[model samples]
Target: MNLYAHYVKRIQDFLIALVVSIVLSPVLFTVSVLVKIKLGSPVIFKQKRPGLNNKVFTLYKFRTMTNKKDKNGVLLPDEDRMTSFGEWLRSTSLDELPELFNILNGSLSIVGPRPQLVKDIVFMSKEQRRRHIVRPGLTGLAQVNGRNNINWDEKFEYDLEYIGNITFINDWKIMLKTVLKVFCKEGINTEGLATSEDLGDYLLRLGRITEEEYTAGLEKSKVLINR
Candidate 1:
């Protein structure tokens, strides 16, 4: 971990998060109500995500899926449980508003690498482990670029690039682009998966569709996600 990187980002994050929390309070309050009414009880979904130094921190997002299960007592996949309203919320990024609280709580920054789950950590290579050196964020270079449209190798490349070249200017650039991406519903998901192509399974099998196949597949997936 870089000492300068830690100190600089911490100070900047504190100030920005404070202001955003203050300004977004009304929107937050309103969304909480809508989530409760339309979504159900426990409007927010809190999950443990790996943060800076591989520490676990609770991540906040609006509940977009139901608790329904099949007769066998197995939960359904995201595609089945995700409601139309949930899809709308995700497309507009309304589902992410609760993360302002995460930013306020010091668990997240407004911009950084998106956090991965505990299970997802097993997928990262040693070289990719450096991403844990900084706090996870709500949006990042990966989010602003191709996001779920890109493969793991490409996403990791963008995440590492963010760590190496982060600055106030870069953060603002990503922020502005994120707003546009949200409106356009870009990089939300590929055709088949609602979230992403689970990198864990892919890496475990060392089985990403092959370089030649992947190049073509990702191009098609990119078009699908942006749509």
Candidate 2:
């Protein structure tokens, strides 16, 4: 790791986060109130997400879905329990506002590979595992380019590419393009979900397909989940 580069990145992240948080405080506060009322308790939904080097960090974001369950007390599917407020938050990209703190705290970068649930990280191939070499981001090459509509293979390829060429210029380009994509709501999600294909769910349904097939599917999934 480049020690000076890391520190420079961290300083930039801190400055941006501080400024953005202060500037967006009113919006964040309003969203918080709405989430509390509409989504019930636990206004901020915190979860363990894999960060740089596959380390774990408690990621913070607004609660976008309800905690409804079936008769057996099992949680409902993500698509079923998605609330109107949640959808709004997702469409506007407001749900991710809290992650600014994550960036400021040095747990993440402003731009890199997006973090995944720890369990999701387990299924990654050796090549895909390279994403952990750097701090995960709230947005990245995959995000600005394809988002939820891009397939897994494609997303992983972009991730690896980002890692290979970790230049300030490339990061800035991604940041600029991300703003446009977010405003246009391009590549947001598939027909039902807010992001990405549910590959983990697919594995369950497909049973034990060959490892080769699974790897192929994951690659496709990365792109399909992007915008």
Candidate 3:
């Protein structure tokens, strides 16, 4: 890989995120107000996610769902907490606006593999673990290709492909495609799902994980998600 592509991309990500955040300040303010009214406090949904080399970082995003829990104290399903306004924000890709800070801070790149939950590491194969060789991105190869519509295996394939072909041109191409995808709202999600299933759940369905392993991973996921 070119030194510029690997080492200097962080500078590019910082500059781009700075400019984008400045330009989008008005929209960010508006969205913050709306989220406060609609989803209540903490307009930003902060979560721990694995970044480059599997290091953990706090990822930021505009909150789009209410924190309503069920009688059992477990959180409600994403579909249930996701209001129409929230869905609109997601469909427009506006909910990701806050992640510019993550890019600017060097926890993420403008283009790479999108970060998954800290607990999601349990589900990765040895090959899938290669996705974290580079910094996570705000928008990535798999993102431009299918977003939440594709399965976990397909996502890892795209991620690994991007890693193998990392270059300035490829990154820019993915960014441009991301813009078009956002405007068209293509692949925002799969049918009847607010988001893709958990990686552990997906592996369980594929029979790649034993029932006990899946349960253990699920517990870990809950702790990570709620932490």
Candidate 4:
């Protein structure tokens, strides 16, 4: 019934990603070198994230933090490891440029729900999981709406709305808004944190699920991660 999601949208995503990657190659290269210099080796960070139909795929981004640990050998918190340069990269969203390769490889789209960490997917409610019905996007309705400023529930709602309404117009509108938001540097962070609040914490605080349920979900998620 949905022609765009079934066919045309992917073609559009492929074309747009290809063209954008080529056009932004210089920026990508500059970011890569800077990341190497500022963050040390491994300029690109790769992690498993849930993609289309909740399938796991390797997501890429520019490295923005150091791998420093405490005397106990425990890694430091994100806020501590993140450098001023890293913060700038995040604010400008240059860190996400490497995802062009993900789009090119057909693991992502130009517009859809942002892919989430595989471990986090375990905590997603049934309805929230619906966001993965389509391929993850480089920039999405949630990203343009408020990015990290919004709550996890709001993000899930926006993602579902986009899933239900897929068209050239909506896609382009989201993309345009994303570019504008990026330039304006809107919703770059939640409060003063580097990212939004964790959905697991949100669920737990709302009494939506108990500690036992959370632990069970983590176990289930680990199985998915292995697969």
Q: In each prediction, how many residue pairs overlap at the backbone (N, C-alpha, C within less than 3 A)?
A: 0, 26, 0, 0
lDDT of each: 0.79, 0.81, 0.88, 0.88
Expressed as tens digits, the lDDT of each residue in 142-199 for candidate 3 is: 9988898998888999999999988888889999999999999998877667876778
> How does residue 18 of candidate 3 score in lDDT?
94
Model 4 TM-score relative to the real fold: 0.95
Which regions of candidate 4 deviate over 4 angstroms?
Answer: none
Per-candidate TM vs. native?
Answer: 0.84, 0.86, 0.94, 0.95
lDDT of 1: 0.79
Candidate 2 per-residue lDDT over residues 58-152, each given as its tens digit: 89999999999999999998888888879889988999999999998889889989997665665677888899999999899999877878767
| lDDT, residue 180, model 4 | 97
* Superposed Cα deviation of residue 103, candidate 4 (Å): 0.5
Model 3: colliding residue pairs: none
Model 1 TM-score (2 dp):
0.84
Candidate 4 residue pairs in backbone clash: none
What lDDT does candidate 4 reach at residue 72? 98
lDDT of 1 by residue, 80-188 (tens): 8888888888888888888877887888988899996665665567889789888888999999888788878888899999999878788889989998998889988
Task: Compute the lDDT of residue 125 as modeled in candidate 2.
Answer: 74
